[model samples]
Target: MCRIAGIFDPVAENLQQRIEGMRDAMHRGGPDSAGVFVHPQLPLALGHRRLSLIDLSEAGHQPMIDAELTIIFNGEIYNYLELRSTLKHYGHEFRTESDTEVILKAYRQWGVDAFEYFNGMFALALWDERNQQLILARDHAGIKPLYYSTDGKRLYFASEIRAFAHAGKVFEENSKWRSAFLTFGHLPEPITTLKDVVPLQKGTALIIDLPSLHIKEHRFFEWTFNGKLKQEDEAIALMRETLEQAVERHLVSDAPIGLFLSGGIDSSLLTLIASHTRKDNLHTLSIVFTEEAFSEEKYQKLIIEKTGAKHQSFLVTKAIFNQQLDDAMQAMDQPTLDGINTYFISMYAKAYGLKAVLSGLGADELFGGYPSFQQQKKMKLVEKMPESLLRGLQRMPDHRLRKLSYVGLQNSAAEYLSYRGIFTPVSVAALLETTEKEVEDDLQELSAYYPVQGLKNGNRISWLETNFYMQNQLLKDSDFMSMWHGLEIRVPFLDKEVMLMAAAMDPAIKFKKVPPKYPLVKAFENELPEAIWKRKKQGFTFPFEGWLKENEYIRPSNNAEQKLYQQFQQKKLSWGRYWCALLMNRFTPLP
Candidate 1:
């Protein structure tokens, strides 16, 4: 809901100025208000840009401080009223009816374990003045971002990486992460595109002692799918109840709330539940296409009628795509293969005067709605092939066989990544100056040290989809792109409670073969019409490939990149490969 930045150091003369510079870089994300905090005796400083979502009064102002602790926070804490009541029981008095004050008090009451009680999206930095330590924590799902860098003297952290970059912090593109970007279309969690800068992982926290600079990392929560199996009807009941609760919690805001209706099952279900929960008329937004094949106005209309929601649809023409491309590019905080759709949607929401919106981003990952779910069976078969044969098949001319070779050679995480990635190691190397062996070695090291380690079959695939794809691409894209318009995008499906419920369900129930999101659809069958559930899944994309044929900026100075573009135009390249090449060429500066 806001942008937060800070400097933690033993000695920095102009700490306030540097912190202000970081906050100012992301001024668009929180144009409503700004504040900075610094003490004369302390070298630390914290800066905040407020969007004013929960409490409109200045009482909600951040870098909120007491005698012992000071806090800078971003995103919503939906259950703040409840937490506030609990803290009152503990004899903590609050001056403001704002979540910011609740967090400060909660930290006082529960210490580091306070994170376990928060039931919403957030990335926060707390300076425990008494302990002389700084605590940084991300929400359970990483719906918000927190990036940090340390020079062994000072620690710089912010809501966006560009903040640090703009505040005179130099960020050299790390070669390893650059190569990983070519393969995955995103840098994985804790790995920023820049050297020495790290994104705090979801469900994780870091404590830094101010004087010693000693750091300790803790995993407060980890998503796992291991709850008791239930009868189909019972499971459906649980899913329905959990989803409705999540939607209600996500609706907590002082600002006007809107829903991004993609005309898909996830959005439709949310519309149904939210309409039932909110007393006022719900505003719904959708993107329509002039291209009939790509449009879904009919389904969107169905949801509107069913929910009695006021609907606003935007028609995207080739002209609009051309017009918005530059603005979207400038809005981008990090180079991504996705988020162009989110950028345009956010602009539409902003135009309608909406400050906050709900998206159905994590439903696909949580409920097995992607083609990757179905491909797991084939992967298991490929996994049976001997390593000797896989190595030999790696030399095969047929690309399909070569991809199968990857499945045979690597673990489930690496194999799933190879299946969903932008490029194979060999293909990525051909595009970059790095060799194929170097790319393979980096991938091997990553797989060996994988954080979501030791999960198998469907569970393994789910972890990768949620942790890597959703964390890196979907949620990260949502943050920068929507915040570009000074908008807050909330995901009910990624809510801590909702994620735990979905993760705990038996994988077999979540991944039935007939319709995608089988359990979720059944849970709300009365709420969502069958037509929405039965429709073929289409990706939320602009006419990017069509636009690529005409885009002048897509042309690259690098010969390898140009060749990849040529292959894409000739229809000889994979979609992921073509997009990676286009993005690299568009973003990489010519010397």
Candidate 2:
């Protein structure tokens, strides 16, 4: 819940100024305190902006160091208490009860292997004075973000891309990333919208040697779904245990916390657990839509009654939606189709005096809670068709079924590109001033980078959804939206231990025959009211269709609107498409 930045140069004249600029840009992330540590030779400088969630004392101040190492860390180590006990065996004296100190001590005792002992979200930079090497690592699931850029002579890193822009690097927009953005709704991970900057991939670590300037990246963790256990009951029980522990650990915060109760199974379960831990009634917040079809107020009301938690709800209207759309887009460090809801929710939480809120973000990805998972199973029949026939099918007219069929013929990565994509290759090309062939070529190039081999069939779709769709789209969106209101969001379901346990369960149990997030629904069956469990997963629907039709800001071309309106009238396209078109129109200036 803090911002960290640093610079590493074997030969640099003034490193302090650069570190100061980076820290200044990240002031919004941490306003409680700020500190800088410059090495004796000025070759390395570490900057930190503290949020003071844990110790709330000057003793928790970081660039925290021991005799061997100095560390600039961002994020929470939920298992710091556990690690502190283990480090005591090695006679490491702690000056404060801070996770930052625990991390420095653990790294000193166990080296890079300390990442394995951590059970929380983090991105840390440890300057090993003894080894004369700098080690950078992200949490197992990438719940927090770390971005870095190197010019061979100097390496600069920060919690946000904006911070890096202040380090005297020209802000050149990356066109290829923009192209990917148009297709995927967000720039996929390992690649940012900036050419020179890159995000450290999830479950990976980097070690940089000071003298040689050589950098080594290692994959410290990987999630696997293949498990030998076959019993559904056993899987449910194990998932319940892991998830409860994850939620309990995430609740370790000094500030007043709440849950973003969506009335969905994931959030419902979180609210229940948080309520159990609180002596007083738990505070639960939810968004209510004016449009009944998109409202979950009834379900949320049911959960509040069942749990006996204090509840607050906000009514979102078209006016609020229109006003916030522009600010939401500008707040994005990377482009994403989601986050509008997250932004509004976080804003509400902040206004209500809540500093932190637990979210149920990763439950969908970890427990097979997307339609794409079940759809991929049905799509498996396409592999049996001849390559020639599949190629011929792509030549068919522009129809929804044909579009879906073409996606089925593609590889897992390409299929994923099509599934979540708003504007298809044909559509984007036709709409843009550029040629369709160019867009297709660009998509192919980007698709090549997708980790297709690691993902196979439904599992492939699941991984792509988790690592790419959820990471780049949902998680990125949530981070900016929540942070914009200065509210820290903790996703308990995304905890490494919980995710690993879920990943190890059989896919059949993870995605039951009933529907998406079936396992989660089944695990908390008794705790949740029957009405809440039986409700269809609406998937965070905003009243986009109603909003678009009401807002005058969105004025589509007569021809386009007529066709789009006709489709809407016939229910050919879900309300989502009209909403996308409306968003594009709202952003587009009149000729």
Candidate 3:
């Protein structure tokens, strides 16, 4: 994994300086090496910061060029060896042992369709000097980020939005997203905090014609949960086999690799699998707490014992949290409250002398491993209730009930927000000083990532969890926070094959009411500790409820929002609500 940036300004006089500025802004993502490629004639420049994960030699350095095709890429292609073998059958020659080279050859062989064959996370920009067009593509799951902005003539793109901001002050605040941010606690896909800066959607590519500066989008993949594997046994087998394969593939790193062992169902299973599969001793890092209620040390210990893992656990006291908090938050490429836990753990990983680490991020989204999945049945019942009754439900004092005001069921995203939303539209408008209609309109744009059909129960909730919550908050947080320490965080659960296999599993087996992640637990029951699966499901989270209270930076800036903080401390409100307010107060009023 690395950082990439470029400017496609046909009229720019100082392309090198602009590209280098963006590259320097993202230097933390790739501290080992850096490279720049500027067209001799045209005023276009491509910049890269290399982390040196797969191929350690200078040959793997990016802004790679081969036969008029120039490329700058971030994220690893885990299956590059297999794809390279196949490409060689098509009579392609390789000069280096690098996935970036494989990508250049694959594009020549299959064009845009080549994306289908890649099984890893990536966000890349390819300049085909022959065709005089620039192509941009992200991975199938959007695990990697690619942000771009246009001023009607120039196109600027990067792996992080901050790269654009520092490139001679190219940043302009997009105040329109404040409504969405207040409602969702995060910006939805294709919307960034900067004006005209948007993320390139995953499973899609944009081809920019160098001459006309025209851009066209091509979607190569779209996620859907059709549940074609109806038989429980078949679904179980596929989940087991695919997960094992994903764990194996994610271990393909030239540098010292490890995993973030949360001691949750997903991470425990991955540790067990990797311990047995990896040639070297499995390394793991975990965050412990002095607060017993918040720490997962007990569960993490269970996994380490079972796997015989080389474990490193750090205790995150409020003192340490406060001391490290500034640098961690500064590492945020975009402002969001979700990544603080990740920020600390990634710092831990870097100090452990590891370059890449595995995470179990997508398992909950894929296998119905969240409370929202179990709550879907009640939501379905509510969706069938009278529209008048549903409208009245909004007046109730309960937070989730108040969100029901948006439940038309015509939009899955709208309905999902009713369960998972941070603030009700009315509440958001009052908080952000904007109209409710404006908030709703901004939220409506999320339909691009919505489920294709009217899904029921677990399937509906999973789609929303994956596309909305996972993509926007969890995955985005993982990208910037982990990369802050120059550590590449790879999620095996979000692997292309693993996602497809999990999406096709029978929901009845996958989303068993008795236990969350039933399929995942059952598939490897023999391999996992009984204590790990039988334990009540607790998410891997920092002690924010307790720690936020200890934080001086978390205080209310004004009395207008003081009641919210009081409610939070009194345990009448969720820490998320209070934390969202803190984040909003700190990051908003953007310039």
TM-scores, all candidates, are: 0.95, 0.90, 0.96
Between prediction 2 and prediction 3, which has the larger TM-score?
Answer: 3
lDDT: which candidate is best? Answer: 3
- CA lDDT of every candidate: 0.82, 0.76, 0.84
lDDT of 2 at 581: 57
Badly placed stretches (over 4 Å) of model 2 are 9-14, 279-281, 381-412, 431-438, 446-449, 454-457, 548-591
lDDT of 1 by residue, 1-591 (tens): 899998876757667788898999999899889999886676778899999888889888887888888898998999899999999998999888889899999889888899989998899999898888899999888889999888777788899877876555566876676677777787776566677888887888899997677889978887777857557778878889888888999998888899999888898889989999763679999999887888889999998987889889988888888888888888877767899999999999999889999999999888888888778877777778788887666566555566666665454347656467666677677767678889887777666435666666667777878877888888889999999999999999988888888778887788886677988888877777889999999778777767666777666567777676777667767666666766765663210
Q: Which stretches in model 3 have alpha-carbon errors above 4 Å?
A: 384-389, 392-395, 408-410, 448-452, 569-572, 588-591
In model 3, which residue pairs have backbone atoms overlapping below 3 Å? none
Model 2 has an lDDT value of 0.76
Candidate 1: residue 569 Cα off by (Å): 2.1
Q: What is the per-residue lDDT of model 2 for residues 218-273, given as tens digits with 9 covering 90 to 100? A: 77887777665569899889878888888889888777788899988889889987
Candidates ranked by lDDT, best first? 3, 1, 2
Error of 2 at 145 (Å): 1.0
Per-candidate clashes, comma-separated: 0, 0, 0
